[model samples]
Target: MAFVILKDLAYQYPSSTGLVLENISLQIQEGEFVSIIGPNGAGKSTLCYALAGFVPHFFKGEISGEVEVDGRKSSESTLDEWALNVGLAFQNPFNQISGAKYTVFEEIAFGLENIGVPRDEMKKRVEDAMSLTGISDLADRSPYSLSGGQQQRVALTSILVMRPRLLVLDEPTSQMDPVGTREVFGVVRKMAEEGMTVVMVEHKVEWIANFADRVIALKDGQILIEGKPNEVLTSDLLIENGFGISRYTSAAREARKRGLWKKEKLPVTLDEAVEGFKS
Candidate 1:
């Protein structure tokens, strides 16, 4: 059985006229790294909320269909219990901050403390997660004093320390620079390889192509396309739907049109572009 499952899922926010997410059905295997790409209002964030058990739990909206993880349905599980196996990091780092913690280390360990994790083990987990995201040096610094990118890293580290079975990240790297974005993607990829199921909503198509096992493009509260990274990232349907794609893919598409590129498949990454152009 798939580790995560969503069947005919649709959700409408409180007092909202229409569904924010419509007719969404997906299955993710254990240890799979899936990336979701769409423009603003594509329901990507809402999808993350559903997977994290916040849709009908905290949002208290009309929802239909099933959200299942590890054979347990979200409808049958309490938010507290669902949160044990699923972790969600919001798009805005400030929204994720607890505001009660003074230092970054404490912010990352707050969840563990709330859950009654042993002090010695909590410290180790916090340290390890901070190191993983290259934030060990910022442990003593105030989260409020850090830059947007740094705060984002801290938010991600906080969730990582909990070691949730399913990790749902909404634009986790939006505030990061190119190098930082690469590092974050690398960390998530490594986690997925180590048996963590990850579903990330991101606009960085190049990184998604390089790291994600699959890509799903959503539009108008529904999935428009989903497949291997290369296929989905280079699909013309994405361009037609106003979805962002990799520059390499855009260039390769133009090159193909001009008869300068002979490859049937377009490039989605720099390495692929270089090789395609060379051949």
Candidate 2:
């Protein structure tokens, strides 16, 4: 079943004179992990908000066409109702922290509390979420006192505990070191493996190649290309349009140009690059 559907969607912010998204349309089936990649200002974040019911609801912008997630249309669904079905975690984790919560544990629990989850169940959910994100040790600390990467993990855990049917992440690890990045990505990938749907906007092509079931390349607020991860990531069109390619993909492309790469298809990860060259 399609968990997310967008048809001919376009948007312009209240104060903006131009369209931020142009005729965007796509459908994400339940349990699919879709990765969106584009340079800054490509409207990736705006699309994330649309999926989470913030574009027309919270932003009060000019939105044309339709956006439906989990069978609820964004044009009509209330933000509160959408929140129960779609969770959004954006890049700047600090912006996501609720100023009302004092401790990290309390902050992660804030969402559950608002939805009237029982105290005992909420406690168990929060603890399990923290453990999944590897933040169990920091649960007692003040969320504000944590580093940017730590706070990002906390924000992710908050969304995870809610168990939204669809999770939209916009560069959720933009501030993290490699290890932290991998840990967070692993947690979300596992969520998808367990039947949750995900749409993530990220610049890290390598990670996307490894875990994303599909990759969507956005440029100038439009979807330039989208398909299976390897196909979209290794496309010459993607490279020409200034979308960042994996380092391995770039190297393989170069080797092909120099008649050193034997494979017809380029590699998008270190392992694939090594194996392709070995053949």
Candidate 3:
């Protein structure tokens, strides 16, 4: 069954702007790892909010059409109810964390606790979340004391404790260094492997290309293309639509220009490029 569904979704802010999303339609199955990639203002984040039921609930926007999560309409649901099924992690980790007084364990437990999870189960979930994210060693430390990557992991663990059916991450690794990026992606990959539905809005094409089951490219608030990672990542349509191509694909194109590689099929990863050269 489709876990999340959007049919002709449209949203417009109350202030002075036009529709941020227009006639958008999508369906995400349970345990699918999907990534939405586009340039700024392509309505990627807006779509995320729309799917999470934050568009009209928190943003005071005019929304039309239907958005259903597990067969419940998003427009009629409360944010609290939506939180139980969809966990969202924003671009900025600082905004997601609570006050300085909350320790890492307390912070992770806060969500499950609010939902009235039993104390023993809450504790187990918190410990499991921390362990899965590799933050169990820092459970006693203050959230403020951790490094950027560590803090991001804490934020992720907090959401993981909720055990939502769907996870929506908006550029979770945008601010981190290379090591931090890898750490967070590792957590995401682990979650995906464990059968959690993940829908992320990210510009890091190179990292997500190998892991994503499907890629959706948005341009001017519309889906420009959607397909497997290799097909979508190597398309000239993505580049023409202003969605950045993978570095390896660009490198392969350059090699073709220099007469070093002449395969008809474009390579999306370095390994594929190497194989193409060998063939």
- Residue 268, model 2, lDDT: 92
lDDT per model vs. reference: 0.97, 0.91, 0.84
TM-score for each of the candidates: 0.99, 0.98, 0.94
- Candidate 1: lDDT over CA atoms? 0.97
Across 92-190, the per-residue lDDT of candidate 2 in tens digits comes to 888889999989999999999999999999999999999889999998999999998899999888999999999999899998999888877788899
**Tens-place lDDT digits, model 1, residues 177-261:** 9999999999999999999999999999999999999999999999999999999999999999999988899988899889989
Q: Model 1, poorest ten-residue lDDT window?
A: 244-253
Candidate 1 residue 219 Cα shift, in angstroms, is 0.5
Name the better of 2 and 3 by lDDT.
2
Measured by TM-score, how close is model 2 to the native structure?
0.98
lDDT, model 3, position 105: 96
Model 2 spans > 4 angstroms off: none
Model 3 ranges with Cα > 4 A deviation: none
Q: Order of all candidates by lDDT, from best down to worst?
A: 1, 2, 3
lDDT, residue 122, model 3: 92
